[model samples]
Target chain A: MYAKRIITTMFLVTALVITLPKGVFANGHDLESLKNTVEQLKTQLDKVQIQLKAQEEKTAKKKDIRDLKQKIEQSSIRPVEFEINDSIVHLAGYSSVTFADNDGAGDRFNQVQFSPIFHYQYKDLMMLESELEFDIGLDGSTTVALEYLTLDLFLSDYLTVIAGKFLSPVGQFRQNLHPGWINKLPSAPPGFGHDGATPISDVGLQLRGALPPLGNVRTNYSFYVANGPELEAITEDGEVELEGIIAEGFTRDADGTRVYGGRIGVLPIPELEIGISGVVGKTEVTVLDGAAFGDEPSRRYRVWGADFAWKYKGMGLRGEYVRSTIGEVTASVAPAGAHWRSWYLQGAYQFLPTKWEGVVRYTDFDSPHASEDQKQWAAGVNYLFSSNVIAKFAYEFNEGRVGKSSNDDTALLQMSFGF
Target chain B: MKNYIHIKTALHAGVLILAFFLATAGAQAEKHPNEEGDSAQGAKLWAQTCSRCHNMRNPKEFRDELWVAIVTHMRVRAGLTGQDTRNILAFLQQSNSVARKSSFTKSSTTSESKGIAGIGVSSQDVLARGKTVFEETCVACHGDDGKGVVPGVPDFIDGNGVLSQSNEVLFNHIVNGFESPGSTLAMPPKGGNEDLSNKDIKDVIEYLNATFGS
Candidate 1:
């Protein structure tokens, strides 16, 4: 038993020595000293055991101590079952209920919106992020949909390869600052949100990254090839023609053709970014009326825009202009063959003395070949309780140069929160 | 022919002027307000100390410049030092600074060093070596999760733990040992690992701060 104890002690000591860094030994003879110390400890332990046996005449304390030591030893020697800590999951989202009163049109509180974002990181190389939006109104109408699902693969310091459905990398508002918590205004500028002139997202692969700073300027860029927007037959207003943005986010290809989109931006300074973006796709459309009623061969749809943002101190100013066009679809019925334009400019200021930020914006949309364009002017203020919670109030004036409005103006009150 | 030369020269000068303006503007926006303090420490401080009274925030809650101004205002209220304030700024910028990209010009390129302007990776070697020291020495007392196994050992997983002590305090105590009037059991210098160099200790400290920080 004594020999066996010596063997086991030497083995454990050797294992410990091998595991530690080579530099951890204080002296050349440290190993020898350790062996001698262990031997002396053994002798002293035996002496103490005898003394305890004579004094207490019981092994309760000794057994308890031995059991504890044994447990520690066992735990220490077992293999570490390390959980795969390569990923960090963050759950961030927002909920908002907005009340709007449209001019001339009866006003009512719309839906309660709950959008939840799941951002997951797999080590340093991959990211899987998605957001789901749910809208439930007091009238019992409900809508639920996946807003976007993006998979990003970090290829290099300067570039990332991305796949899956992602926000159109074309403009400032669509790809960034579109989240409810991040958006300063309660509603997107006229002609810019979900029903905007340009498509907001597509399904495809993309490459994006930052470039080395140029002197004092910094630049970032993105390029994508995706299942592009297709011309859809618009049935509204008793119209039957391939129209724009009707099937904008369709993931499946209609004519075995893909669309190309890209954006390039440069920071003229830390406070400002100027960028240009464009997308091109092809689709077939057959207008049953309005001029060319026959099946039109596949035609190319093109969109291009410029956006800029300048922010300093507590003031932010931004604007964007987008133009979309289609090849000879129709002159009367399918106006997409003509030209359409959308543009907006906004300014926001934070009165630091108070937690209130005031904003003013003007947006205009010109339909294809329309004699009159639609325009809106808006102003609002946000009282921030914290970074994640805010209360907002806004009013907007809308007018059509040629058309009629069920609501000529609107006002809104909103409260939004996120975690 | 002479007219063509004049036109070419004028256009070249215009391009140069635009480039110069862009560079100058970029510098204005990319200015690092302060270069002191470490971001890891700032994250820990923000997570543990500031969140004590208020809730934690996502980095995207404010702009980078706004964050700097807010930190400056709160420094006096919170009684934080200059280093602490700067570290917090760095943390906020790295965590939440909105990335800016160059506008599209070229189609694509396969090249080295094409990356995000403000993003960077830390030295892997130092972190790797530091992790070795931690496993060999630190795990014995401050167990795998930096939770204390003994009565006197302090927990390092939570905020304000032994590891979160100011760098100065950690340096002094770790270099020496826990020596105070009311101390029950004192930790040994270098956690009783006599062979550890000052660099080894520093590396381990950095590893702990980076890995377990907020």
Candidate 2:
């Protein structure tokens, strides 16, 4: 009887479930509405997060721009340059060519030259200046050489340290003057240009700067130390001959000794500059084959020099004097004491209206051992197309102390351009 | 001693040259316009005027003394006044230095315009309105010599007074009249006459530039 009651109760409950109302458990609309509400909440949260990310990114980008601007401003305070990676570089250039006629040597194309200048700078403290020149060689081939490759460390306005190959400070022409565009004439003073009396380049260290001005007058100085030149002694036809070979560029020291040199310049007025320079050093050379087969040791290549430059109105005047004393060679039987002297004077007048400049120069050189005295006079005119281009015509009259005045006269024409 | 007594003799000649230069240039040091010039203005003028005819030159092309003389020499041909000459010198000096320029372009341009401010006046247009009105009306106190006649008057040739002001400022000064507390004299409206029109003021500005700032 109990089992039968249990079975009846189960059947009654099952029937009650099947008979429930439609609204009691809610329709599909309510379930769909709840799902839409949840999806809407998720979309709103995503929008808010995206907006926040955009604001953060915008602030970061603005900071990056500000940093870039500050870096540019700081870099601009130094020498102007264009950046590549970690280095900054600048470009400059010079060039020249010439046609020459000589009484003894006949007419010929003298020389052609092109030079490019480069400057690389680091921060505001260090710098490198390089110049490469391509010149016509004796065999009519182009020869390349480094004019100067200097490294500079800026110490202050009053001091800068320079090293590597540098122009000699003993003569202003070798150091401060002689660019094709800057020089008014087609040629420089005799015995003062390349391969002349003074060595043009030195591998050395130098201190150079302009001193404090006195009134409106300006003053500058350069002090240097370098490997000195070489002096040679030879025996020919029972006579002792002495010679000085001035080689320039990066090279090993000939005598394994250093030279001390300095230049002091003063401008009493803005239009004039006066200077005194000197050098003291050791020089030694080995005689190839002679009565004495050993090296001829000469410790003294003492030099003294003076120069001046003045310009008034459109006229410019410049002059220089250099003297050298070579010590006696120790390996030769005869005492080979040699003294060398050179001097030149040049004047130029520029016609402002036509951009034309007329120049005249007189030069004299005395070489020891050869006992030769040479005198030269030159007259030239320059037609400048612009500041960077010039055409020059010049005539030179040369006379040795022993030869006729007309024996070695020459004429020259040249055009120069720079970018 | 060296055998070339000529070098010693030439040194004597060098001494003579030094003496002569000292005598000539001792008190004869030239006063350049660079000392008082506004370099910013000069650079702008150089870019605007000089670049019209040719490419620009590097300041390292000449020494300061040579640059001064060159600028002064060209002034006569170019018709630039003392003020413009000085400004050019200042620009060159700052440009030539390896270090940063001591005097930078002003951080804020007090009188500069934002965009294409000045009218595009061609050479012919400027020449048409050249110094006729200036000669007839402005030459009395301004002087026929081009310098200012009065002590406090505007020196058009030297970039003084109205010449120093911008085009808009100068125009307003002329149109509305000007009287400064520091100055005793007063500039009448429309340049003290009934003949000057608004176009006349433009002509005078062109005349000033052509005569003194070219």
Candidate 3:
């Protein structure tokens, strides 16, 4: 039994030795494979972490883009809407300051005038225009005056109906050339001022427009009926004599008379214009020595004028003549006739490439009173900063009745601006 | 006398009624169509009419809307025809905007030293187009004889006048604006016609050379 046990054990031992050798070899190989697998897992984990980081960076970039787009949308300017039918208001005007030295009156800053023109328009149908004048009086006080006001209605392509106080159609000087910036000289012509031969203004309705072109000759006409002028009488040397004619636009027709007047301008060429004007009415003496008067007889009143303007390149030439006559009055305190007449010729030449202009004018004024009759020559130099802004220097030589203010020579320096 | 008073009153009433009727009729009539203005004709009329009364105002002095009102006011004051008003307004409106950049391309035959050459276009066609443009645009200030009509307009017929310059210089002057040495006004770009193309300017230059060049 001992011998059999030993053989069995030896056989079992042999089997165990072969199987343990094979198993040991398999275990070592498996451990080497396990280590390789762990290394592969580590490499895979690193790759996953890199991919996740890439995705996170992409998301962050998208967020920045969104924020930038939001910022852009927040800041911008939009357009304003405008319609055609809306009412439009425009302001325009002229202003002037003058320094004057007269033979009798000393030199001073004698005039400061601001004329503001306001326009309110409702399409092309109608427009309301007004000019307000502000002046510094000689007494250092401010005076406001309405230069003119008109409601102009466009009746047709070539016609307009105007209602209100308007610049008189009697002459071109009062209507067109009176603006300080437009007048080449620093002062108005000798008798084209207040209470001059030319009527200043009228309150009435006017029809003014251009006529159809007649060949190459164009024409414009203005017709009006207005409250006429009033007369003044003075007590001098125990006799009543007509003093002056107040032709400024009167709000009331004290004489209950109407004046009919019209002006026709013909332009044979673009550069030349010839105009003729006339007025006929009746006027009564409403004031006696600056006081109100009653029961004065109405007298026949008439005014006539002629004017011409020619422009060539930088040179301009213009002339005007006016006459006013009052018929004799038999039933009034002032029974005598009176008349005023005046004429002026002016020429201007501008030196181009330079803002300089030279002007000369000759004027003759004849009035009822000998002391008021005058003849004058005016010469001026102008510097234009722009087309609308001008500086003028003028000298006037006057000849009249001796020792009268009308005979005083004067020098004027003026700066005028139109906007 | 009483009969005279009655007649006068009737006349006044008649005048008032006539004015009212005219106003109402004008107001009720059809509004003017939004017609395009003729900038070319407008330029000519503006040069001729504005100087008749006052010095020429700069187009840049006011905005577009303000020009409308201002021109309307001038229409009444100057007794301008409706066509005249429209034309002037168009010129002013076109002149007030920012100038456009020139689209002129250098021609193959054109050299820096030489003046300019007709690029693929016949000289005859170029000159014809140029003449039309000049008459329509420049004739107001520059007369048909090429002598200046206005005070400071440069004479193209003079020996040493504007046409004596190189074509390149003339092109630049027209594309941009130019003011004469002694002029009170400056020529607006493209002669105030913003619609003028680079080719139109080129043709005009050629026309000027053939017709008025020294």
Candidate 4:
């Protein structure tokens, strides 16, 4: 009976062990699987963080690039430009090259000229202006000349006081229209040139200004007191007579006389200007046939001029008349009174929207010497490369005394630039 | 002897006249104060005065500082008033800004190619405003007859003239400034009026077409 009971206990224990082991092993396997999943999830989170940081860095770089582009765009619209200060120095002027063929003289590249204008300004009150002309002469020599120099004081809105050598205020040609780039043709009017009827320059004190508008009319004036001009006389064939008037700025007044002159201009319309000019002085003959003279009595000198300019659309019309007279002096080598008279009428027209322009001028010059008198008609056409640059071709028909150089017809081609 | 007497009398007269002018100059200055320059008035003066002696210089030819010197020199040469000088300077400075390349787009290109007007405004008020602006600003160089008064300025009445271009081109030119072919001078942006609005430009373009177009 004992042997049978022991065997039953053993069987019961074995059955219990088998059933509990299966259930417990299953739960342990599930916990191990959950631990593996947590490890994989942590690795994935690390990778995602790295990728997010990279994306954030790239976005920042893109924003930086956008800002740089915006800055470039803003800078392009209005650039930082130059600033002007007080006490400015400026240089401006003109240059010209010409080819000419006269009736008696052969054609050649005869002219090469450069004129430099210097300006030094102190605010709006004062300015020092000077012009220097350099020219290549026929003798292959270079000539340098001071064209004009003046210290301009702006006294008021309407007036300026100018001191030093200044262009003559007698007429418009010498003062306003003599620049190569400004003049439509290559040559000056017959009597408007040097040793001609008009005065070239003067060393003096000048008061110049424009007046306030009177209704529809505007006016301008220039008055000056200067060292008077000197007279030149020549002795030929037992005759002594006045040769020419040296109206340039003289450093010394040998005659101890002063000249007074002025010009008054009236503008009836904005496009039209009329002017009158006059001068009064005493002049003495200082040179006789290119020789010095002494003890010459002073002679009366007078000059009067009238000028008009009208512009309508692209057409311009202008005219000027001048007469210079010297009274007789019994004590002088050339005692006979002499007079130089001159007149010119000019017209210019521009073809709009084109670079071509046409100009015509007629001039009559009469002097005491028959050989010096001239009547001329000048016609020209200009092709403007710019407003300040021009190429001109002109022809002159001249009539003077027989067998005189003044009677020679001429043709000219020129290139001029104003800078 | 009589000539010497005449010279003395003329000298005295000149001195008296100079004194009178000196006395009156201060009064004139006081009467005309140093006011801000008017670009419109300057345009008129430039057209009237510069062409009287020389050809009109393009405003773009010189920088601001250079223009100041040149104009000052011209003031002495031409005997211009101080006010006139300031006004011309104002006009030159306003016009001296450099031109910019246009920012054109494909959409705008397509519309322009199709000849479709963009941002159309047909109001009479806008047209009248355009007319007034043109008269006040452009009449100095371009006459009331739509023909240019100055050399190298385009004639608006010509069928194949500047108006023949597309509206986009015209708009770009008017906004940024333009230099015509073979022309030395360039038309300044907004006709040198910086105060002009984009709408004003468009209206003027329309007016140009309606009035001066072939």
Candidate 5:
């Protein structure tokens, strides 16, 4: 009790001292006031304590004393639970509703999704995180999708490394973060959506860090390898097989590709951020020899792309241009041809700092081999009720076509919440 | 002689280190505000410094209006007199702005440091709401001040150690009533009053933010 009183008095004195005039301490006027307040308050406290003690002695009951002792014991004992100091672990979930339309027949899909993220942190060095997503967009089924699970190692004050399933370091948006359903312009960059063939998440390892080198800014870089997925090529007989083997000890080097990519970014000012990135790699494919001969060897595929992003205050501007090459297709099969280019220009403006945000963007993709181009536009708004909870609504219009004659259009709305 | 001198030097360093730690510990101790500091004491302070020009209503009435008025009033008050009536307004605007202004000496600490997390919440509002909840339901002994005026009336603010709990714990206390003997005060559901939403209890807990949690 004496210790507690002394500490409280000291804090009160310091606070009083700060509130005093510039030379009040030197003039002794401040100390005088503090002394007066302390004396008066202490005298009053003593009287109250005496009165309380007298009352307690007069009406002391054995049951009451026993109860008081028990209460203190319960309150003083800490609960046994996993805790990182005072910070507690919590389960966070994010999801959004999207309505999409494509200019064509009724091939457009509209749906809602829930992506739950579990994150655990220990001070500044380590964090364990995993995400699970439920999508009703494709086939309208709830499939258990492993988003990413990783143990992030903060290697230095400015750098970090991760060895686990994580995003492929392909572009600024694709690697470190994803555009929110509402924060993105009407349409995402051409090759980023669900139907796009580019990879969003990869099972691999990555080393990324920032350097406050020359210039009036901090720059960053990332290197990563993507664990490719299994894909098949159709044969004359409509059969699918592994794509790289041809005969005894014969192969095409078309096995699953390892994705390699890096990014460079600069924080010119506290509120302004800019970054650019690119990735290249060959992905495996199962090819068909013919219906009579069955499926034969695989084919090595290559994909490469670049992107740039900028954010200032509540406004953001982002764009990415990518080209992928799928080398050889089949024996006499027409070549998959030139670079398949995809790009988009997007911008967002938040109403109040980061609480409510608005976005609009346009995207288009032209396949080197395909006859048609896919294009889209999106506009949306997001409302952040708190730091952890948010509501978003967006409308997207999509179009896919070769000439002006045959094209597809789509629209959507989304709301997501996560910490 | 050289070895002895080295040992002496090491001893001197250790003593200096120990003294530094002691001083810091003492400083920290002096800074911790007591949870059980009398509300009447706060009320007295409020009356003397605050009541002079402003109206004294139930804290609920002053909730929204008081903040804009207080923040603007405090600057002029600071310029003119003592402490600018700075009485742990943690309960008023949950964000500790005054504390930040005191600690952040550097000019470049962006507005990002002043998060909206603790904005617009005050302890008095929480206490007033907590008291109302306790009263509408706990009429028998735990009287208005949350100090249980009668025998067995668990003083929510003091002796019962309720005020020492985190907002969440206090929330559970008021939500899930005490069923055991030492906790005989039996906090009915929402302190017996079913009308108060869980949000009400959260506000009360936010009021107690300075009490239980750092």
Candidate 6:
């Protein structure tokens, strides 16, 4: 049934490609040609399978192994295969969920989300990928968002350029997915705000390339503009600092803000990867103008972080730290604190060798009083259905301090498909 | 106590030297030799000897250390004992190292080698024999399309000078399994069957050459 579904999907996609606008189709003719080739191969395979099935029935119990061999030869008299280059654009995705129980609170399911993605490539180069997410249940925030749209230009075997909105490449977990439903000892890393701002996506450009000496070194960097928090300058007290400022209405709200960041990573060995990433930019915030809404102010924010990851023989360990500071220069707005820091540590193991991966992560933030400012512990497992899709389930335990001290526990289940 | 101290110091020094040698060997071992290994023989050995358990391992998977381990393991698996295994190991390590080092050099030397069997297998009778050998041994994994089913199975379509490998290199892998860690499966000795002679494997290599390209 699954094979039938896959075949039907391929046929529909092939037909869709044929009817696409010529301009769009022409741009990706290489992809179209590869798709056609795969389709043709599938057709030939189906025919061969049908013949093989018929022969199997004919041979039945009285069939001699030698006679079966001769039957195979007779079947082989016809072309079992056609032209050969094996290439195609694959589409896939995956999702995860978790349930948890804190110290004394009632056990509950925490977060659940789905990330559906599409990937295109041939020969492992000239690739494009995009991820979309829709979250509900457990945490139950019903909305859809674009996760990342990356166009990778592999310049050479070792050099590549990625452009578009993507995970800021900040901390390890910011780019890495959740292991299961549990948070490790220290889950939240620095720079990520109380609302867990680490998975920040922005429209920007990046260049990722490797250094010489092949396996010794590699680096990734990016520059982008994205939606960010507002920053306004406040006096010693909580008053806005707008002494000698000319308010220009030239900035359009839709124009958004500018975000610039870069990440440089290195892999000393094939198993160990480490990197430092930083982002600095301005965000727009609105103020009340004597009971009326004021213009959006450009708030300056900076986030810097470092991460280390070791993956060898199915044992994976990763840790990251980030520090974020926001200073608002807008007049009349109160100045917030200097900086808020967060950090986390995580570890995972593949119990079923390379088939199933289990993860544990822990995160803590300074302001544990806010709804989103609690320490999180989560654990989960991922079952790889194939190289591309996976089924995941996890549990999270969140303890809130300083404020109301409500415990948020969650159970999440998700299925993600990707290319 | 005095003797123990001396032994400990010597052991420390020995450890240090071995560590340095292994590290340096790992770091600097990428200088590849000229294309000298028999890829055809390697393929046959892969089908005959290696395929008994696992699929054919593509040589391009490893850098150096892993390749060394894998090829050495295969030597033992092929029942080459010790000395035979070592010889075969030398051939594989030399060939794989050359492929890697050339890819990274100031200029790539991969294309410099001549196409395999530029002279041999040109005769019709020789081509016919080579074809038969291939049908009997190589046709399964390599497939009729010449695009093998498993990943890492190098397509014969555009492989440069793959068939043109030196007979010695071919014989080494054919007689001994590929020992690279990157190889998921070793090419068994003498294409695993042990029935064919070194010359038989050579004929198939020639057939691969004649069938794929000019």
Q: List RMSD in Å for every model shown.
A: 20.7, 17.3, 12.0, 11.1, 26.6, 26.7
Pairs that collide in candidate 4 are: none
Say which candidate scores most in lDDT: 4
lDDT of 2 by residue, B1-214 (tens): 3645566457445644643443343322233244466555554434332321122355556544445544442332122334555667666655444432112112224223321134236366655664776665565445555554322345566655456666666655655556443233444454444346656766777677667652
What TM-score, over all chains together, does every model reach? Answer: 0.55, 0.57, 0.84, 0.84, 0.48, 0.46
Candidate 2 lDDT for residue A223: 73
Instruction: Return whichever of 4 and 5 wins on DockQ.
Output: 4
Q: Is candidate 1 or candidate 3 better by DockQ?
A: 3
After TM-score superposition, what is the CA distance of residue B91 in candidate 6 from its true location, in Å? Answer: 21
| Reference-based lDDT, each prediction | 0.62, 0.62, 0.81, 0.82, 0.46, 0.49
When 3 and 4 are scored with lDDT, the better candidate is 4
Residue A178's lDDT within candidate 2 is 69
Docking class of 4: acceptable
Query: Could you report the DockQ of all the candidates, in the order they appear?
Result: 0.03, 0.03, 0.43, 0.41, 0.01, 0.02
Clashing pairs for model 2 are B33-B86
Q: Write the per-residue lDDT of candidate 3 for residues B50-120, one digit (tens) a residue.
A: 77667778787787778878888888777676667778888888887656653342442343323344533
Model 4, native contacts kept: 0.46
Sorting all predicted structures by lDDT, with the top scorer first, yields 4, 3, 1, 2, 6, 5
Better of 1 and 5 by lDDT: 1
What is the Cα-based lDDT of residue A265 in candidate 1? 81
Q: Which fraction of the native contacts appears in each prediction?
A: 0.02, 0.01, 0.43, 0.46, 0.00, 0.00
Tell me the interface RMSD of every candidate, in Å: 17.3, 17.2, 2.9, 3.3, 22.0, 16.9
* Second chain TM-score, each model: 0.41, 0.41, 0.82, 0.80, 0.34, 0.41
For model 2, residues A1-419, the per-residue Cα lDDT tens digits are 44654465455445544575556349788657645654575466456656877887777577798999999988766443221223445666678898888776778888899888777755334567778989988798999989888886544434456788987888667764566766666777767776467768788777665555567566677777776665555567888666544636436676666777878878675556788999887766544443223444555678899988775444667889988777775564446777778899888776643467788999997777443567889999987676568798998887774454333778989888766
| Model 6 lDDT per residue over B12-43, tens place | 45644643443343332222211123444444
Q: What's the TM-score, to 2 decimals, of chain B in model 2?
A: 0.41
